[model samples]
Target: MTAAKHIELMSVEDYLAREELALEKSEYLGGYVYAMAGARNAHNLVATRLLVELSKRLEGGPCSAWNSDTKVRVRTNGYTYLYYPDASVVCDPNPGADVYHDRPVLVAEVLSPSTRRSDEGEKRIIYSQLPSMKLYLLLEQDECRVTVYRRTAEAFDLEAYSGLDSVIPLPELGIELPLEPLYRGIENA
Candidate 1:
């Protein structure tokens, strides 16, 4: 007798329908529902740190900073996908009522050893599907380096900075963040 192979997962909507009353948040994608993973210590620290600064800078502004609790909806070929980045800033608020944001201007994820690949790879592609997104930022968990992806008329281009002396520029929001204080107190990070 041969072992049976598992069937592929369902779409984002189907997964959500099945787990209507579930406690944990789920990210819906093509035939898959990824249980929202709790961040590692370093992940939590960096995310919190970034949010604090960004929030302060964006206070009373048109842009709002949302934690990972917010889900970004990506629509492609009529398919809808949901992903939760560590932190995101959105100018639009019409994602849904009592739910996550749909159209975001900037999305940032702190890259860990586990999530580094996907956060920098697959998520980038999915995020590009959103026309509202202008910048996608990736923060390294073990270092003070940051990589920013900016969308241009032609294509997206990447710019990298290491340490606090470097500033992360968000021309879309007319803001530039000083990287030095964001990485303070990161252990071996």
Candidate 2:
């Protein structure tokens, strides 16, 4: 009989410290870290488009848009997790000394086949747990569909939009993001 081997998990502090020297980005969940996959062309396009539009709208305001490189820390069920959304908007003036932001009013994720399940499932649930999150956008890479989850007093409300004329309204930020830019350079398959 073979003896079972025990694997030790990395602490959050060590994980964060190691991440600074890592060549590629990875996410921290509980005591384990998971490597993040690279984004596809369509995914990058959508993220960039949204980021640009949001940046334009948030210029000189209390809020600002952050690209995927900016880490977002989320706390849920007594566990701490760090993630990098496709794009995020943070309205808080004080972001703390850590490299990650704890309060993001908006978080966007460009859907990919490999990550679709986790994005729509675990990520969704964890993101909703954020007290400051007002809107969550799930952009489709294969199509022009954009799903918006607006937070309400009770729960997050769902809204879906498709087509170039449709616009996503973020009442919290007072910005209306048009959908045309998101699918601008996506080649039809």
Over 34-131, each residue of candidate 2 has an lDDT whose tens digit, in order, gives 99999888788888888999999889888999999888899889899999899999998344567888899999999998889988889899999999
- lDDT for position 124 in model 2: 90
Candidate number of the best lDDT: 2
> Residue 103 in candidate 2 has what lDDT?
90
Which stretches in model 2 have alpha-carbon errors above 4 Å? Answer: 1-4, 93-97
Candidate 2: 10-residue stretch with minimal lDDT: 180-189
Q: How many pairs of residues collide in model 2?
A: 0
Candidate no. 2 TM-score:
0.93
Query: Model 1: which residue pairs collide?
Result: 9-31, 10-31, 142-189, 164-180
RMSD of 2: 1.7
